[model samples]
Target: MNRYKHRAYNEELMDDLTAGGPSMDQTLRELETINRWLGGNFVTIDGLVKLLKKSPSRPLVIADLGCGGGDILKLVARWASKKKLEVELVGFDANPHIIEYAKENCKEFKNIRFEVQDIFSEEFKQREFDIILCTLFTHHFTEKQLTGIFRQFKSQAKIGVVINDLHRHPLAYHSIKLLVNLFSKSEMVKNDGPLSVLRAFKRKELVQLMNDAEIDRFTLQWMWAFRWQLVF
Candidate 1:
């Protein structure tokens, strides 16, 4: 396999989705259902808090890349409120529709801001945030694309970047496939769930990606049967 192949979502796919040929509402609904089943928010937020506890300074600004419907942002907001940790959250995604949905869903949290950003584009500012989080989103990128993202992330965040994504394993793949079918009937869930596992990274592959991106001052760990974390 060409590890450096650009497998991330292409402009054509984004254009097609933006053009309104398919039912976006249905797709979003399915995505939400799949996320819930995967328990991604629970795993990611808990892990983040654990990591933050070890640090001396509190994170003032956090950017949740690939924010999707802002579900994870909502969880982080709630957690921050309980901890009395004042934080400003910026949610970014390439899809405007998804960003709009995130905004609407997270309207109750005044601290959370949602915007459309292309991670691969030069328009994205650098070194402006305390932390940059890419959750359940990295599988979209191939080695080369991941390298570019990590470079951007390193330039943008002073503290470090947190990457919470899937891990590819045969057991995990089959389990999630069955779980999605048993839990959700959304076609999008059924389609993307399996594909996500297949496209996911292994621990060594993730570590190598970080190294290839020149991110040496960080640690990577795996959890939740198939979730991986890269923390610095």
Candidate 2:
């Protein structure tokens, strides 16, 4: 399976709503390590920093969609502290189990909160945030779904939306597959690691998605380890 080819629809094991407990906890924790090791978290951080530069003053609200375990939010909290930025952060996950886990994982941050909200729902559409973030999350949906989701984000976010996801390369797929197989114990990570690359976006595909979403102002940068940092 080449990433240059059409995206793979084969679902990742973690996509299952029923997945949880030790296996899910292990997968989430391992994912935190994997993202940190890959320098993946910084891609999202850079995008947020770009938006923050536009409006350094004024307290802001940031919403992280599909925030698994709220690991990225922790980094955001730390960054906010250093910058002395007054920011209110909230995390949203479709899975209630994941939401519950994220609450405990990010309990130290008094400025952060978590909620179980499906992106497609009316309640989510009604809510607005200054900056919306989706880190390694867009790949889970199809092109059509993403087009709609991006459109919603354009409406929901007052500043912009930050999207950090995979670049869809064969090396990314194979390397993650090998790395997870070598070091990961969770079955979900073992199955989802490679599958995510196959499901990820190409530059042209992302451009098409942006065009379809009617988003004209944006920046797309390819980052280290085959990651895409798209801020719109």
Candidate 3:
């Protein structure tokens, strides 16, 4: 079977988000470097900058779904500080262990905090954010799951959403496999890096997903390093 023909069912080590320790910590650290070097981090930042243009006044609340180690939130925090934009940034993940680690990782930023939130839960739905971000997230679920998630996100985000996720392609798969093998010592990072590409979305799939969720106003652009920047 051609695994790339569909979202791969193969599980990644990061799937068990509850499992965290030195290895997961190392994985988080390495991912930060990879994202920064590959220019992936800027995708989210730029999307946010556009949203910021709409409303420069008042404090904005931003929540990151499936936030890993809170590194992205740290970037958002820094940007807000520099721009003098007051933002209450919250990083949400279902994994308590990861949330704990993220909390520790972002201790220096007083305005940023971490929370354990299941995106589909009632508790999550009741809460609202000015902008919701899902960086390298959303690909972890199947089509049905994402459709439902889109609905939830639309309801929760007061402003809009910024999604930075992988694009399923051969080059992305092979390139990540090669890069991880060369620099990663953690087995989880080595195995999951390539698998993530296999589980990512294609542009057409994203369009269909948006239609299903009744989301009409949105911009979907392909980014360098094989990523999709979907801003809604």
Q: Candidate 1 — which residues are off by over 4 angstroms?
A: 1-22, 54-59
lDDT by residue for model 1 (1-232), tens? 6432323243223233362214555566666666676676566776667557654455479889888888787878888888778889999988888887778878999999988888767678543787778887888777888888788777788766778888777787788789878876556666677777777877778778878988787777777757887786
TM-scores of the candidates are 0.85, 0.97, 0.97
- Candidate 2's C-alpha runs over 4 A off are 1-3
Answer with 1 or 3, whichever has the higher TM-score. Answer: 3
Evaluated at residue 142, the lDDT of candidate 2 is 91
Which of 1 and 3 is ahead in lDDT? 3
* Candidate 3 lDDT over residue span 38-118, tens digit each: 999889998998777765578999999999999899999998888888999999998898898899889999999888888
- lDDT for 7 in candidate 3 is 82
Q: Clash pairs of candidate 2?
A: none
lDDT values, one for every candidate: 0.73, 0.92, 0.90
lDDT of 2 by residue, 17-41 (tens): 7778988999999999999999999
Looking at model 1, residue 145 earns an lDDT score of 80
Clashing pairs in 3: none
Best by lDDT: 2
